[model samples]
Target: MISRASLRFSLGRFTTAEEIDAAAAKLVAVVTHLRQNAPAFEFD
Candidate 1:
């Protein structure tokens, strides 16, 4: 699970567009990995 702390850390520390993009990509990867590993789990 991606915690609010992790999201805040990523967004708070990144100031440039590239940094934000990288952070977003990393977040997407985390979500994808979780989805693939736990298909039956509900996100909401």
Candidate 2:
């Protein structure tokens, strides 16, 4: 049976382990990019 709830509310029913891993990898890449490109903060 197919579920009608959205991904965030699927109770992990419609989500796969590979999908979670891919999402985590994407998040890490985004954070890494931001860290590498963002400027350092200066305090007066």
Judging by lDDT against the true structure, name the best candidate: 1
Predicted candidate 1 versus true structure: per-residue lDDT over 1-44, tens digit per residue: 43333434634553888987897899899988876776453434
Each model's TM-score, in the order given? 0.53, 0.59
The lDDT per prediction is 0.67, 0.62
- After TM-score superposition, the amount by which residue 17's alpha carbon in candidate 2 deviates from its true location, in angstroms, is 0.3
Clashes of each: 0, 0
Q: Model 1 — TM-score against the truth?
A: 0.53
lDDT computed for candidate 2? 0.62
Give the lDDT of residue 36 in candidate 1.
Answer: 75
**Which residue pairs clash in candidate 2?**
none
Task: Encode model 2's per-residue lDDT on 1-44: one tens digit a residue.
Answer: 32122234233678888987888799779877866665555111
